[model samples]
Target: MNVLVLMLTVLNCLSKASERTFPRIVPSQLQFLEYTNLTVTCEGFFNDMIQWRVLRKDEKRNRRTSCNKNTDAFGACHIEALYPSDSGEYWCESDDKRRSERVQVTVTVTDVILESPVRPVTVGDHVTLRCIKRKKLKPSTKFDFYKDGVHVNTSSTGEMILHNISLSDQGLYKCNVSEKGFTKENLLQVKAVLLELPDRPVLEGENVTLFCRDKMAASNYTTFFYKDDEMIGNSSSGKLTLNKVFKTDEGVYKCQTSEDRESEEQWLAVRGGNSFSTSDVSGVTHFNMFYLSGLIALPVLLFVLVFIYKKYKGPPVTNEEDEAKYTALTKRDTSLYHELKPPNSTC
Candidate 1:
């Protein structure tokens, strides 16, 4: 029985590692105009339970029904009338929660513009930025580039390339193109890469170590570790150790080499042993509930106060002397009219 169990474990690991991959979304542009239709087709074997998911920020939006109608033949889905809230990373997943590679979509309720990729890119990777012109792409000569409102480069092509992007290359990049004697500018952002973190969960009071790796791993460079954007530790051995982890230590952790090429930031969850529960209801955290309730109720409370004031106190008295005169005149007129009126007559 032990031999059979060992064989099964090995087989499971191999099966997981050799799992078949899926093709990306065709006509793959990340950004789109609001109310536009997006048709995406999966290019791989599809299971009956296969569905699509959207990942925005740190949260994932799961679909209730199958995105594809005829999965046994072709796997495709159409999104009609996209909104700004629809912008996120989209991917296909099986019933068992096995997910395929993600494709990002950003729907904007603005003019046609260029957009950057929604996916995180690593250092030494080629990043491509695209210019979107409504439903289709258009060609234009004399393209000007700007970084944070500072002019950088000019190209005859609409697309701009950042070959082997580094830390300094990360910023808000804008492209200006003259179309029909009118110049339109669109913005895109680039970010630095973060380092890989520990996969295993660190229990409270336990020690944790972080490592930084880059493309030039062979070269020797000092490593710096940051927690919640604050520098916490640094080491020459390319590794930093945090002794006695606590719930306070749980935050976004990242590292960077001396070359300034940073790694991807990852959340470090310190669970067990008096740690706070991370389980949330429908992806809504306690903090989010409080924040949303406060935001929604604040304006309503202010509106109620304003309505009560207007109903009871009426409008503001901009000219106090004039208001007083008006009040006095109204009272005097009412008294004189009452005095001049005839008394109640009894028949």
Candidate 2:
């Protein structure tokens, strides 16, 4: 019974390890215009037991509901014709009560909404913001863009392309259409530097290379890396390669260029070195659960087998004749010892 309990405990741990804590959003953006379609997919090997979760804005309490009759085989929840009421926090949740990180979704009902990524864009990235009108507008309509209420650029295609975004470009942005009013302001964030690393969960003892990239800078700049606010290493190639990383290496990391331009701190999570397949669901895998379960069960099974063998195999049994012979030998040995004893010897 104890062995069975141990095995069960191991299985439970494996199940927890395989759980993914986030869902994937189609189109990869958080904000959308009203009446648009959005698909939230639960990605991972064990996503079959996962479902979509949303907290609508107008609701006084949290509510859980299924997709709008448009679920696919991939565990995706399709929300068609999203209205402003649909704007709220969204995430994925498993039946075991594990939840993914919540993402705030905003659905705007304005006649014009600026099309931009809700997520913060890295520095030196080329981003384009489009002025999307609810009603069909002329292709040649002139559009004006503003950064913090200051006119920056004008475009006839209704799209403003930002070349090599820098820290100075981070501000509130809104666009104006010909004769139409300005769209709602959206914040455009830019980082001075970006540390590029693997998208998957990093396992312990694996070699990881972090690349400090600054697309707008010259190639001759030096890059420095820090872990938990402590300087660890630096390189001229803007790359810091850590060989045989351990769990101790897991921490918040950041990089800076020679010009003191720094990037946003990112956390490095080092998992166990055990071999397991990971899924896109927040860097957790599913198939490795069985493999780890077998590892835990093998030793317990061996121990149980040895215990049973000892329990069934009792001590050696002796017949009556053999017991009498052993007794006679014992008496003879005692008589021989008495005969060999010295006269002066005391008991």
The global C-alpha lDDT for each of the candidates, from Candidate 1 onward, is 0.59, 0.70
**Lowest-lDDT window of 10 residues in candidate 1?**
12-21
- Output the worst ten-in-a-row residue range by lDDT, candidate 2: 278-287
Query: Clash number for every model?
Result: 6, 1
The root-mean-square deviation over C-alpha atoms between each candidate and the true structure, in angstroms, is 25.3, 15.5
Candidate 1's C-alpha lDDT? 0.59
lDDT of 2 by residue, 1-347 (tens): 44344444434434543323345667666667888899876554222323434322233346654443532222566777888777767765545454555556677876677877655678778999988776665454688999999999998878999998778899989888767678777778787677875655567889999989876678799999998789999999999999999978865678999887887655565667763433332233233465568889999999999999988997656798789999999999999999999999997
For 175-291, candidate 1 gives per-residue lDDT tens digits of 666662312333333445346545444568887877777665556778888877799988887778788988788666678777776765565656556522233222334455676
lDDT of 1 at 11: 36
Among these predicted structures, which one has the highest TM-score?
Answer: 2
Residue 144 local lDDT, model 2? 92
lDDT score for residue 141 of model 1: 64
Off by over 4 Å in 1: 1-32, 37-111, 136-157, 180-193, 200-208, 213-222, 229-232, 242-249, 256-264, 270-347
